[model samples]
Target: MARTPVLAAGGIVLRREAPPRFAIVRLRKRNEWVLPKGKLDDGETPRDAAEREVLEETGHDVEVHEFLGTLVYDSGGRSKVVHYWRMDAGGKPVRALMSDIREVDWLPLDEALDRLSRGYERVFLENVGPIALQAAANAERERRTRLRVAAAERRRAQPAEQEPAAGAPVIAGARAADPAPVRPAVTPEYAAADAGEVAGREHVVEVTAPEAPPSSAREIAPIAAVVQPTPRKNLIERVRDWLRRAA
Candidate 1:
């Protein structure tokens, strides 16, 4: 079976002002703004390839946030599968100096769409834009959650710092103090009086036990006589009958 031609592609939404914008890299030779992408090397995963390609094609270091989708296209009579990803560039921009990449430039989405050479590249941009936005949102939410958790942890930690020193007595002269509050004791005479009052109340109870009737009176039928037999023969008898029949 022929192997699938897999390529890894990465695009950055380089933000300058509010509502951060995507940074499109322009090739030095062609001066065409396009997403940084490259074919996957042996043993390299799609994510690793995408990151490598983005770094190689663009001077800016990037961290991949999420996978965008796969793009299938025909190249030199072979089907090429390009894995797309949303990436965030770290710090300021740098120039891509690889042999294949002539130069790199960051462009706004509108400018990039106008300057990009291929129509398919526009489709890739469209697909990656929403995913990148969602990734940014998720990152913001995670940051907020972490901040809240850290604040809660700090609050929890503060109590321990403000707490009294360990082994310190809670009450001064506690051992010499008169005594803690005590409940009144119940005298035996009082308890007996209470019990006598309770005994005066009328009540009835019904109880039964499996005791045989008096022998002098009459005998009752055995419990076995009332029980009905199941359809199947007992295992012990069946085994014996089987053995006898076999013999």
Candidate 2:
């Protein structure tokens, strides 16, 4: 007949630091340094037990996150199964450490693994440590993203300050300021339409007509030179001229 497995739970508690750290505890009885975990109380769920044990051992109230994994091994003659979750510890400790825990040490993953008294626990940590660290990093990135979004929202909510009008009055002794050129806000769609209209439209130019000459100046005709004609002699004048010539 197979025996029932002894159930336990804990956390890979992460502390916010320069490079981040994990929490481990020293047992009071055996002086064995191990991950913060304990056997589950009756009627308690694994999740709740994990959070409770981590708080008691590490003395920092942690926000429980995703389930990391479970470690199954032999403890004394019975099978032991320990469940773990990713937990984030912030600020200072809210409560004192439990009597079962002698002390708590926050360390980097490699150092924490080396400090553990049990080989199985070390192997478990080696696998899950990266998972916990990644969760912490993701949480931090989310927090920063939220802060940026909040800042952007605030900026959008505030009223924009009015700019001074172009060609503002100059001071008595100050140099006259040049007016800034006003550019129309043209969207790409509008710009394309404007370009098409300009290209299709015909160019119109205006020309001034020359004035006609006055009537008085045009009425006068050109004058020609006059000549007198010699008169023809009558019969009496011809006879007189003949008698005179004969005399």
Error of 1 at 76 (Å): 3.2
Q: List pairs with backbone clashes in candidate 2.
A: none
Highest TM-score against the true fold, candidate: 2
Can you write out model 2's per-residue Cα lDDT over 111-135, one digit (the tens) per residue? 9999999999999999999988988
Best by lDDT: 2
Which segments of candidate 1 are over 4 A away from where they belong? Answer: 1-6, 12-17, 93-96, 160-247
TM-score of every candidate relative to the true structure: 0.56, 0.66
How many Å off is the CA of 47 in candidate 1? 1.2
Clashes of 1: 3
Give candidate 2's total backbone clashes. Answer: 0
In candidate 2, which residue ranges exceed 4 Å CA deviation? 163-247
Candidate 1 on 28-122: residue-level lDDT in tens? 67666677788888899888888888887777787777677877877776777888777777777576458767666566566666766778888
Clashes of each: 3, 0
